[model samples]
Target: MKKFIPLSILLATLGATNAQADFQGTPTTNAPSWVTSWDVTVPCPVYVSENQADNIFFEGGFDYQDARKTVDGALGYRHLMSDNKVMLGANVLYSHEFPRNHQRISYGAEIRTSVFEINSNYYHRLTDWKLTGVDQNEEKARGGYDVELALAVPYVPSAHFRVKHFCWNGIASNIPTNPIDDLKGNTFSVSGSVYDGLSVEVGYIDYTSGNADYSKAGGERFLKVSYNFDIFGTHVNKATKPRFSNTPYEFERMDDRRFEKIRFEQKVISANKTDRDA
Candidate 1:
């Protein structure tokens, strides 16, 4: 009963929290002409040009620990293709210890379609519990892998210019250990925001595994909530025709030597300013 209680409580809390996080505004194309879709997950790096690369996201949050508080941090990257119809990215998360005191790294990729998106994630948990000649209480749980496949669809896209809804289904499991494997399961998620760059996600998970007969009845469920921040990329169209104007700052690549001279003059001006300030 005690074992079941901890899992039950965790699912309830995170699930409830994620529901609130899913409340975001409608999708907008104004973000960037190159952006394919709204970034609902961690970012992944994809290079589009010699100088144009994808943006990555960094995240942190708080949780409970040995009768106190703890913190968790994550980082990820995302990229959009030229057609602006496909998106891809990856992310990793690590949380401090509560009872076991360990760190976990999770990374995966996501592909987006017009109607839905598919996600494949892999994670491993690492802990320092014991050593060959160390203290008995110094044992550790090294590394393990978890794989989850999820399918999500945007239902309403955006409602009242305020809320957005999405539904997902798939399976998740610990591939390394059969004890924590989940054979069948599904997840429900929603997201929205009060303003740009500020949003939330609410998720509920229901899963069943081979050990369900010996495990708790009703399978298992969890709730999660999260906020996201965005970093944008800068890109230029090198293949396009050039347009020049007779302005102090207006010039074309045809006059590269002339611009080089201008750049030298600007450097001299900047150096003079530094000297005067000094």
Candidate 2:
């Protein structure tokens, strides 16, 4: 039953949204974006045919993230298209941080072809306080989004350059509002993978938040190394066929370039500080 307990917890998160690592209103300038992502899928019957196949997969995994250590889980679905040269999928993620007791959820979808793919995610913060300390639940950057386009260079199979845009959907509060386009960010990165569930990424990231003006535009260098335990894609290119390696597991990966919304917290805090001082 030891295994059942963990499996149950993982399944429970399926009703959840996507996931992310923890933050105390600060940006870990170096960590990639997956730091803020996850997806969940409800189980459904599977069908396989010569031209098409679809499956419901359950997965769970761990992350010793740079910002905070966290546990994440998810369920997802995928379908092959165009003779398996193209694919479409969607997922929801749920994550909980061990340190600050932060919780996060997200949802996203993607379409991948032999040559390129596009994916997008919507993120929501679940919890923002320390269970053992003061209830400083002043979390504001609750809802945000990111969309990415990755182009594969056939020569290397795993080599690709991605363009991603992150937009802070203002702050989440009882008061309704709209996203301020000025509070947005972007990343340009090159990624490649090696054998045995490993990959690497290096990129330039730039963004603007509340306290930070878009005009004063800034950029930073980002790098990451990721590894996974794959029942499949262990010998093949996980980058080219990520589903084979990632599906049927319990956790949605924390993509290294997916964390720009961290900047929006500063925007929210800056506004609050101004009101207090005034």
| Top candidate when judged by lDDT against the true structure | 2
Worst 10 contiguous positions by lDDT, candidate 1: 262-271
lDDT (tens digit, per residue) of candidate 1 on 78-163: 56564444456566666554443445555556654333445554545454332323233232332323333322222322101111
Error of 2 at 47 (Å): 8.0
Compose the digit string of candidate 2's lDDT tens values, residues 1-278.
11112323533433242222122233334444343322211222233344335644544555554444556665566676555555677777776655555667778787765457688877776654233333432333345778899876434445567889886554433323422232466767776655435666656555544323432424444455555544432222333333222222222222211110111111111111111112
lDDT of 2: 0.46
Q: What overall lDDT goes with each candidate model? A: 0.31, 0.46
